[model samples]
Target: MSFDYDLFVIGGGSGGVRAARISAGYGAKVALAEESRMGGTCVIRGCVPKKLMVFASAAPAEAAQARGFGWEDATAGNFSWDAFKVRLDAELNRLEAAYTKGLEVAGVNIFHQRAHIVGPHEVELADGMRVSAKHILIAAGGRPYLPGIPGDDLGMISDDLFLLDRLPGRVLVVGGGFIACEFSTILNGLGVDTTLVYRGDKVLRGFDNDLRELLTMQLADSGIHVRLKQNPARLDKQGDQTRVTFEDGKVEDFDAVIFATGRAPYTKGLGLENAGVTLAPNGAVAVDEWSQTNIPSIFAVGDVTDRVNLTPVAIREGHAFADTIFGNKPHNLDHGLVASAVYTRPHEVASIGMTEDEAIQRGGVEIYDTRFRPMKSLFAGSDARVMMKLIVDEATRKVLGCQIFGPEAGELIQLVAIPITMGATKEDFDLTVAVHPTLAEELVTMRQPSRRHEAPAPA
Candidate 1:
């Protein structure tokens, strides 16, 4: 089949960009189309900017802790949202340019327009240009989702956070997921009266229960009003404030309301149906182990596939797809045992593999749980405590999961994930020498199970 290019990629997010670049490196004629920015959600609206905000938000707490170290005038000063926004925007611009430069250097044609599938092998751009390819890849990613309720438009999504002109005086964060929890802590630390309201009984629903409980306490200690089992029934704009009516008919007003309820795959109007590509019930593009859609010529990766929605996973999926189809190196991404981190103030939460709940459901499981005030926080007289937990399969003693809640928990989990990914067992972890005088040492030193459960026999 004669085509304009060997591969046509839609959506220049992490997945699409990686696939296009790698395919081009393999000497395949490739082209990529991006409707908006090059770096997509992670670099532009998500992880990068969110982490910077996390860093910015921690200054106040750090300053107060300096008093224990003999620094007198260490009180945190007023934060200027305007100043931070300026620098953040500049950094985003620089990152976008770097992505563009890399794509160009890789010999991938860049189209600064929205592209949609017109046929299995054909894509039409926003500028009325039609491009044909032997294969098409979709990596459109996902977007913040808001429920359909009265006056819901009064609320903002996560994407709108980066574009806010000024920080809100009193903010309400809606959702139980990591986004809601992280932003709640961020805003609270930045001196905003932050209230986090989730419909569920707890925040971080799928995480280890101990970690969730510890984070809930830490969030409360940090002055974030945590309201569980409540959802916004309606939102209305009253003057300069947003009036939120809860499901129980309780009303609260805030300067701004942000909904981090969930994310929906960005598959709307992409012509996937027209191309005979199947989509999941949640609107995610349906794909198999190799990220190939029902139509073999059309493939999808990243959040659009609704697989493991992490940015790094998406990038890996993209690389694997390119290698398999273009580089003659067949490979597939293993979605299991992927580590993740949530940036919440006063403490960070990170986990890999299954949660305690998940482990319990599988079969016989053993849990090693520990909670204590770290030496640094203890010496500083801070009430903050760190929680470390390990879930192991009882039959094999293989570590099924690890969860940590404390400073550098995210960084610690990355190293911990290496052994876990390599199928390290509980005995192996105990055999390792502990890194004394460190919070991570607890992972290696815990030799006793705090709890054990045996799954019910097959019915």
Candidate 2:
């Protein structure tokens, strides 16, 4: 059948833009539709801008430490929230222009309009323009979920945080997810009276138990009041301030409230129903390993599919989709060994593979863990410590996971992910020679197993 474009991709996020560019490179006529900028969440509101704020917040901490280190900076400069916000927008605009230029150079047609799936093989734009393609890809990504509560409209989601004209005087951030911790870290570091409330026993509930505990203590020390086992029941507006009521009959006042509880797939108005696409219980578009929806012509990836929900993972998935559908090379994404990082105060947590809890649940698991203060931290007068854990299967001696909470934990975890992805054994990590004067060496040199054969070795 004749098609307007060989491949028409909706949502100019990481997956959509990559798929469109790659498909076009393979000599296919490709058209990409984006209701907003092309860089998606990572470039827009999720990672890039968030990390920049994290870096900005770190400056004050560093300056405070400089006096003790004999670096004489008698005067400290005040950081302006207004100036940072303006500069952040300028940088984001530059990135958006770069993305647009990249797509143009790749010879892919770009559409700045909301796209809806019209049929199994057709998509309609907001302007009522319809395009029929041989294959339609939906990488529209996801959105922040705001709970139904009184004055929830006064609060901001992760997206809305970037658009704020003024930094909040005080922020009552509710949730325990990675996003919640991250926002709290940034706001607290920037001198905002930040209070974090989570319904769980601890923040970062799914992360390594040791790391979570260590971070909780560190965050408390950093002046962030972490209220655990409690969640917001309602938000009341009291003049210019927001008062949040917790389930446990606790109320706190703040200039703003940010709900980083979770994000939902942004497929509500995409017309997925008309195209015969199915959504999972989590409200994400259901897709097979091949990224193809129930209808073969329609495919989905990135946060929309609820698989991994990481930027690099999304990029790889998009590449695999383009290779399989357009280049005739089939590839499936392996979620195992996906590395993730959480930038928190006093510690940065990073991990790949299963957590200790997950390994123990599987049964017959061994854990080799280490906790120590780094050499630099000792002289730096920091009382913080680093924690590392390796979960291995007793039968095969294969390392199932690696988790760390320390300085440069993200960098250390990424290096370990390589071996984990290659199915490296515990012995492989143990045998690797340690690099002296480094924090990560503690991970490779973990000799004393924390948990080994709970009862006895299998006969």
Candidate 3:
């Protein structure tokens, strides 16, 4: 007997759209529901818009450096915040329309409404319509979390920052995660007096310690007041300015306060409890290796389940889930060997797998690492630098992890991740010929183990 639908996906974010569209292509009847825009967090608020802002903020600095490259006079003039807002609005509208069109082109039924799980095989939409499917996938993504301070109403979350009516002259950024660091860098680069306040010692807490240190230095050098080991206690507004008081009695005044602290699973009103689906204590829909929920017919992916919150990771997980469940090709998502990048000024940080500290804790590990200034920076009189590290298991000789900090770190780490996930060894990198005049070549061309293990002979 044919079922109503092979798959029904909720949340039209990256994961939901990809899974719904791909599964439909495999002859599976698929229906996708999204209460918001199609592009999800990345396109609408998180990554794409944020990166565009970062690019806009860096243009002045780039133009200034272009003078050294032979231009007698290279000056970036005053930029209007309103002009940027207009451009961003037009671009975002186009992106959302494109995502919708893509899904429509894939022959997937798109429903623009809130979806709720009335049962394992049944879903109800906000418009009083219901649909039934063999499998229900939840990919609601995540929303920025605000601190529970006395005056949180006076501040904004990461989402609100993108749709602001006006740019603030002075902004206070709270949190220690990638979001906080990136927004702080972008705001400061755009000539805003940005003060980053974090409860941790550094901005990116779980990233490689070396990269964290280097990024901290770069942010500080760029004029961001890095306030560590501090927590926001309260906020007071006085005629358009917000004064943030820290738990330690430190006070900072700004035109706006941004809480980039963290995000929770976006399952607020999906009625998961009514459907007997298990959720983690933190409110994420619990899932197994195959993205299956406690209820066999229900599944979840992306930030909703509290796994790696990267856009690419979510896209991969969705594809794997669709392949495993509908495409008849069983697949399991391996979290290791996944690469990530932080968009910060002067230096970009990228990494796959464990850090040196983590490798040491695992025991019987060897780390080969290197640091140097980029060649292009030398002629430009720029102090920007690049660093790379390789972590390997001593006994097995299997490459366990890799991390890089510098220009194009994100671009360089992708190549390493493929071989690393394939279980390539340190000797494999040693034998590979270096790509001359490229920053990535430094990853494979290190002369010796900077910290652990022995040097290998060249190929």
Candidate 4:
């Protein structure tokens, strides 16, 4: 079929950009459209800016802890939100330019307008321009979701955090997910009176139970009022304060209420139905392992697919999709054993593979768990302890998973994922020499199993 381009990509996110660039590199005529910024969520409002905030928020605590290292002059003074915001905005602008430059270098036509499917092979841009292609890619990503409730508009979402002109004096963070927990900690460290309210019994619902419990204690110790089993019935603005009425009728007021409840796929207004593309019940675009939609010429990736919604995973999926269809290197991404890290105060949480609950559900398994105060914390007289756990298959002794909650947990997990992905066994880990004077050595030093469980026989 004759078309304007070989490929037309909607949403210049990590996934779409990677797909477009790689496809262009393969000598395919490509064009991409993004109504918003070029870098999408991660670069503009998500991981990039969020991590910078994490670093900024840690300054106070780190400065306070310096006293233990003989630096008597160290003190956490006033933080200027205005100053940080200026630098953050500049960094975002630089990053967006980089994304645009990369796309241009790859020979992909850039359109700074929203694009939606008008037909299986046709997309209409916001400027009333229609473009036809042999294939279409959707990588629109996701956005923070706010629940429908009375006066809910009074509350803010994660995106609002980056746009705040000034930091709130008192903040209420809603949700039990990583976003809620991370922001709660960040705000608390930044000297805001932070309160975290989650309807669930515990936060980080799907993570290892031990890690969740440890984090709960750490958060409370760090001065974040953790309220579990509570949800807001409504939110109302009252004279510069947000009044939150809980489902149980308890009322609390805060300078701001941020909802990190969850994110929904960004598939709206994309005209997927008109193009014969299927969408999941959660509004994510339905696609195969290779990211192909029901309509042969249409495909989706990244948060829009709701499959392992991490930036790196999305980029890999995009690269894989391009290689398979355009580069002539057919392959599919194995979504298993994807590692992730959550940046929280005092420590971080990271994991790869299955959780303890998941391992038990699979079959017989053995678990190794340990908790201790690291040398640095011990010297500082801090009560915070590090946690390390390994979930191993009883039958094969293969390490099915690993979880760590401590300083540099994220860095450790990245290296640990290499062996786990290669199917390393518990014995192999035990045989490895430990790196002394380090927290991660505990991973290799633990020789005894803390517990073992046998799965129930088939019913």
Candidate 4: tens digits of C-alpha lDDT, residues 273-367: 89879899999999998899889999998999999999999999999999999999999889987999989978998999989888777769999
Q: For all candidates, what are the clash counts?
A: 0, 0, 0, 0
lDDT of 3 by residue, 183-221 (tens): 998998888889998888877888889889888888888
Q: What is the TM-score of each candidate against the true structure?
A: 0.98, 0.96, 0.95, 0.98
Model 2: which residue pairs collide? none
Candidate 2 lDDT tens digits, 22-123 = 888888899999998879998998898999999988877777667657777733477788999989999999988888888898889898999998898888
Model 1 per-residue lDDT tens digits across residues 49-75 = 999999999998898888877787898
Per-candidate Cα lDDT values, in order, are 0.92, 0.86, 0.87, 0.92
Instruction: Give the CA lDDT, 0 to 100, for residue 26 in model 1.
Output: 99
As for lDDT, the candidate ahead, 1 or 3, is: 1
Q: What is the C-alpha RMSD of each candidate to the true structure, in Å?
A: 1.1, 1.9, 3.4, 1.1
Runs in model 1 lying further than 4 Å from the true structure: none
Model 3 per-residue lDDT at 301: 90
Q: Candidate 3: lDDT of 317?
A: 90
Which regions in candidate 4 have their CA more than 4 angstroms from the true location? none
Runs of candidate 2 with Cα error greater than 4 angstroms are 72-76, 453-459
